[model samples]
Target: MSSTQEFIDEAAKIYKVLSNSTRLKILYYLRHQDSETDVKTMVNDLGLVQPIISKQLGILYRYQLVCRHKEGTRVYYVLDDPHVIEMIDDMLKHVKHEIKGEPHPRTLYDNKK
Candidate 1:
């Protein structure tokens, strides 16, 4: 396979991981936090069950999207990449503009004159 195809395949895998709403929520939650958060706190704050949060956290950790540390009996997680949050924020801005029927702000990739 060519390098371009390899890049596309890897990008698709990342999008697949980010496509989960639960994972997105977890990312967003971590983004606003000042420190590492435990699964139990996420379960309580996000109103999700422990297993579901744990599973999603595992996936996020595997993707290198979140970092984790084990202290005592609890495992805490924090956002590993701010770039991921920025991407999500930009997409959300695009979505908001779409919903409001507003023009999209010009990006570096915009080709219009």
Candidate 2:
């Protein structure tokens, strides 16, 4: 595979979106839920203001990282892709190993060299 500036810039957008702790929390919450939830539910569950939840959700929605639907007057959200959970899990694992001073397995790029 080749790395291009365009690909790197596009990939950076995803990391930027996930960089916000509140967005990560929202993703984690939705990942564990059996059903989609509205902004009110998220606000209550996260203890955040509705506007804040809505704003973060807007970013997720724009990136298609979350599925959103409107029923009646309320909009509900859920995880759009299961891979996001796996990505988050893998990143957390890497961070945990770094924190513990444990040697990490060779990454894909490392193996490519």
The best candidate in terms of TM-score: 1
RMSD of each: 1.6, 3.1
Residues 1-113, candidate 2: write the lDDT tens digits. 45798899877999999999999999999998899999889998889999999999999999889999999999999999889789999999999999999999987999889
Misplaced by over 4 Å in model 2 are 1-5, 106-113
Residue 35 in model 1: lDDT: 97
In the range 54-84, model 1's lDDT, one tens digit per residue, is: 9999998998999999999999999999999
Per-prediction TM-score: 0.91, 0.84
**lDDT by candidate, in order shown:** 0.94, 0.92
